[model samples]
Target: MTSIASTSQAPPLVLTVAGSDSGGGAGIQADLKTMLALGVHGMSVVAAVTAQNSLGVQGYWELPPEAVRAQLDSVLSDIGVHAIKTGMLASTVLVETVAEALAGCDAPVVVDPVGVSKHGDALLAPEAVDAVRSALLPVATVVTPNLFEVEQLTGVKVVDETGMREAAEAVLALGPRWALIKGGHLPGEPADLLSDGEREYRFTAPRHDNRHTHGTGCTLASAIASHLAMGDDVPAAAEKAKEYVTGAIAAGFPLGAGIGPVDHGWRQRA
Candidate 1:
């Protein structure tokens, strides 16, 4: 007789190495929620913890480098991941440690350069920015950065859509196979650019008139990693992720007092 565990089919496993958002809107919480909604098995390595709510991030604490390493080892040793997404490694040590651990992993990696929170609170330390650019970005399969982060990492401010190409070029120089520049901050239609230094793919969606998109970045990056785990190429994975996030943004509802989050369970609830 086949055991239940053996007979039951398991979904592709995607791992997220990120900070813990006590608010449950972004970071590891959002990543896992996005992965689950996209029909993937989600695992996590908590790199930091944030005392955050809808209003803003009040305080954050970084887990020690050794603790972060232990968590990564425990997950990778027994149940290997098909893909990885990283977010909000708060300190230089954490970033370097995560980068080193991921260096041995062969799965596709999505690096969400989370610099600030939805309410303009800093997530990653100012000094750690260099570590993310020099260490994490180089080993990423795709680096997803919004306009602020693009400027933070590359010193190139994206004032409009035309600056996206330059931002992608700057990010590609950091050694990632693909660079996904999120153009949601622009005034017109929301668009994202996925580039591999040789070719580019553009995904556009009608801008939803919603202000509760707190976790959109984390959600999008995790969705891409989830699709990559399911065997989609970088371009297809990004497009599907964008579609999923657009719907989520459309369905986003009010949470606490300030900005809410994208609805990860929009499909089931809709």
Candidate 2:
């Protein structure tokens, strides 16, 4: 152990710009947990604060645009993240502010268009949808949207695997380098569709019956960011993230008499 510090390497830095979940299930908490489990240094810019638990989101208050911008500038200017993941932007102003901050960064950006929680509680405002489409998504390296969020952002309702491509196309038209349409909400198998404007890829995993998937979206997006920070391309990153989330979903466990979070440290537990 004489000079082990000289041989040690620092982990890649990944940043999450999201809301805070008081119950430690979703948002910034889940993002950091996923990043940690995936071997990355995680940083956070909390855009909003939520009074939430396993049941549902009670109320959330968005940080002022200036405060959000200050936090973003502090991290991005000094630490210089390798990748950025976004979630739960509660208002149009915060979304716009975050979009501007991300536009200046050279790192890969993972945008999780979080529209609702696992319990069907709304996380994003209706007015912020356009801001996300016009400002946030355009700057994204990969946009991850669940079925309902896909419909919310792109107006493409994916009822089956056949509709996933359409949904990906709609999101691609918004200008992200890639779009990942998450099919976890669809019945039967859990599938995710990823696409650039020209090529398409589909990842399917056996559906798990566990209901404690409260943080899947946040976890998946953070995992993608972590992979990207570790030098994987967008398609490769999404594929790996899909694999990790599938395992986490299978390992989900109940908490507080309601839905619980996916186990971010499932690999260690296994």
Candidate 3:
């Protein structure tokens, strides 16, 4: 047999700046898993460490701002990311630090604005909300906020799909290039609205009755970042991410004694 040279190119690089989920379901774990499933290389800069499981979060400790900045610098200065996703920035300082770091990067940024966990445990500090709104969101290429997160960030309570446009508009006022309002908490079919303050796109998917959707937010944001790294436009990335998460939610399996996680590798199983 003759020797052959390899011609495979390197995969797109995505970086997640978030907390560490001990349960391997959310935060950094979920981000990396979603990136891998989407055919992208994933890197992480953990901003906090959580004592979390399927049941709930017991406690979490935010990393020092210096450490978080160092990790971000180390990654961006050398490895360089094609897209960046942020979640669970527990404090104002960390949020500002990350925002400052990302302001200089040329890559697309996805902000998940995680305020609480699936079990209602607070993941972000009460004071950090201001920083996220003022600093972090301004630099975001796209901001993904669930209903509860929408209220936290913009005080827009979405009772039904009708209110999603208001929610997206409110988030867009904060300065992100685009806002994606996730209406998964509403009754009936799950729908998400993506808007750039000018054009709007709505994505709807059949609702899955499974309760094992612990990492849906993180997974969705990471998937969007992965698609952006792969060169998809914001609207295209959101559409693909919505499709991916819907399948993952449908394939969600129970874990531990409480809610489980969406299957990141659901596509492989199908």
Q: In lDDT terms, which candidate is top?
A: 3
Q: Write the per-residue lDDT of candidate 3 for residues 120-170, one digit (tens) a residue.
A: 999988999999999999999999999999999988898989899899889
Candidate 1 Cα errors over 4 Å, as ranges: 1-6
Total backbone clashes of model 3?
A: 0
| TM-scores of all candidate predictions against the true structure | 0.97, 0.96, 0.97
User: Compared with the true structure, what per-residue lDDT tens digits does model 1 show for residues 103-177?
Assistant: 999999999999999899999889999999899998999999999999999999998999999999999998899
Comparing 1 and 2 by lDDT, which wins? 1
Error of 3 at 112 (Å): 0.2
**Candidate 2 residue-wise lDDT, 66-109, digit = tens:** 99999999998888999999999999999999999899899999
**Sorted by lDDT, highest first, which candidate order results?**
3, 1, 2
Candidate 2 off by > 4 Å: 1-7
lDDT, model 1 = 0.94
Worst 10 residues of 3 by lDDT: 182-191
What total of clashing residue pairs does each candidate reach?
0, 0, 0
Per-model C-alpha RMSD: 1.8, 1.7, 1.8
